[model samples]
Target: MDTSTGATVAHRSWRSRRLDPERSLGLRLTLTVVAAFLVLVPFTLLALLVLGAWPPLLRLDASIAGSFHGYARDHPAWVGLMTVWTHVCGPGPLRVAAVVVVVWLVRRGAPRLAVWVVVTMVAGGLLGALLKLLVGRDRPDLLDPVARAAGYSFPSGHALNATLAAGVLLLVFLPFVRYSGRARVALWTAALLVTVVTGLSRIALGVHWTSDVVGGWVLGVAVVASTSAAFTTWRSGSGRPSAHPLREGVEPELADQRPEGGRA
Candidate 1:
């Protein structure tokens, strides 16, 4: 949204041209479909597992957990690291981080994106909680659990919290990262790495079946995708397509057309 070069129509061309309602609607529908699939597929899988509809997937979960359990036995340092990761990626820490992120977004004048972040986190939490209650799957039973976690284990809370936070943050910041393509990709990669590591940590700890972590990922993708679509819709309507990062030297004229706080 830089405006230093006088008139700067070209600078704003990308946003203006790309914000077409038809294109936006198409993107929104695509995202919604993807989200719906992510959500429903995982829920159906959980139902099947709960009802013993597919005994093989349960055996596969056990086999994968067994592999992780075997690997963890020889890697004390890895076990320690995963334990630390579990606590750090737990719901409590993720919620605190989400609050910090939302405040940062609000301060950067992208309150709409802030709302997206909050809503995604909340949705992920609620969905994970509900799935756990409905499935009532048990945790992995190992002779020596490297780490113990309580409650139902159909969806790994650690994995869901990490995915929701990382996924939403990535989506929320993507549109504003126009200047640094490498940085954008690197950020996305880092988010993916953290999410995967968190899921793996649960398995290594012997606290969750492998399917639980997978379910967490599937459910988290749904919530994050939904939030992404909502955020883009808000950005298209609010005219602050580049409100995030706050690095654009000059704001666009459309930004002036936005509300006083740079929000919708």
Candidate 2:
């Protein structure tokens, strides 16, 4: 009995070491990808800025807005959905929702995720603000069939906030969903489609230039990638056990033992 117990202990110890390998590797890969994206986005943006592409992009945005305005004029029912989306993407309620999610994460899950949530929120807002100020691009003067308040409109706040909220929420929720191999692909495809439509809505509403929407997208992606890296690294280093209870329960068995006869 004593010998068998000793063997089990040794096996478990070895398995634990083998399973983790290096906790930092996932974090490192995430950081590397984010860094590559960051380097690429700005260079592309600079080229567009230098080539004076803003005029055409703005015109495109205006045309989209005009199209939507015409549609709304023709179909009054469509106005309701647009209003709902505008409200959902607005600053006040979205910020409150972000705070609530962060608090929930800090209390129930790893605090690292919560911290990243907050950081991403702040970074998204600040980056959008700075870009808008620096770009100083004018909002569309063309009359919208549906009137909106006047503002400086490079890097649309609606697009930025919507993308930030949706992207971060997806990051937080993805780990929780139990997706089969095929389901995961479908899930990601749907998520991409929703994100694209939401961004386009801002341009369609005459609230942002096309370049503004593109910049918002770039910033949102950067924030999600970088925050995911930082959070993963922090959680791995803490060694406080997974905050995910289900994961904690299964990890020991899976990580510490191999299937007999190659059957799971």
Candidate 3:
């Protein structure tokens, strides 16, 4: 009887500690890191490994890549269209977009978010570049290539860049979405569609293996999700006092973000 009573008490105590907002906030961040960086990143790499180093999978990858290239060859018009989004969501464009967004955020009294945006975009791009070099996979070859790209190719840069650009923009603007109706839903849907199309365009253009695009998506989502987790932790940990529209408010994030914050 005493043992049973002790077990129940311990369980409740543990639950209380785990559910504490302060600790729970950190816990959520940890989980996000595990899921994105540890799990998904590794899985993506392993798939690339199989696709790159394994003979059987290599044959399959080549077949699909060739088929995609052939389709692009037959449809020149589509190639032009795909190129439009690919260029818009490419590394250069994404960097420019990041700078523009950050400048706007800073001007709008959201300096913290501006900093976060820069860090996420720059850091994510650097990480993706490192992974591509480490993997050192080659791009698809064609006798009559529809388009040309230069770089190591285990993970598609276009796909990764597109996703990060779309994702970061979506999240940074989410706080200001101002409504829960079709406007918000449509915004998200459009972002998602653009990301997907950009990734597929790389495949169709004969520049990347299907696995490469999949890996890019995984890596991109991981980077964005990790950034989001950090933001959430900051908000829940040091969030400031505010009267929310619903009378329930998440904290305002870093002390530096507060209007009268001691630290900038």
lDDT of 1 by residue, 1-264 (tens): 456754576756654554545566445455556657767786676667755747788788889888989889999998999899888877898789889978876676667667777888888899889878987888887988777888999788888888888876665555545468787778778789879998988988899888788878877877776666565555555654533322321122322244346655
Task: Name the runs in model 2 displaced over 4 angstroms.
Answer: 1-55, 179-194, 236-264
The 0-to-1 C-alpha lDDT of every candidate, in the order given, reads: 0.73, 0.62, 0.73
Per-candidate clashes, comma-separated: 0, 0, 3
Model 3 C-alpha lDDT per residue in residues 35-150, reported as the tens digit of each score: 56674757466566754588766777789988888788888898999888788777788779889988876666777778778877887789889988888888888888988889
Question: What TM-score against the true fold does each predicted structure earn?
Answer: 0.77, 0.68, 0.80
Looking at model 2, report the run of 10 residues with the lowest lDDT sum. 245-254
Ranking by TM-score: 3, 1, 2
CA displacement after TM-score superposition, residue 121 of candidate 2 (Å): 0.8
RMSD of each: 10.5, 11.8, 5.4
Off by over 4 Å in 3: 1-16, 19-23, 37-52, 241-264
* Model 1 stretches with alpha carbons more than 4 Å out: 1-31, 237-264
lDDT of 2: 0.62
Error of 3 at 145 (Å): 0.9
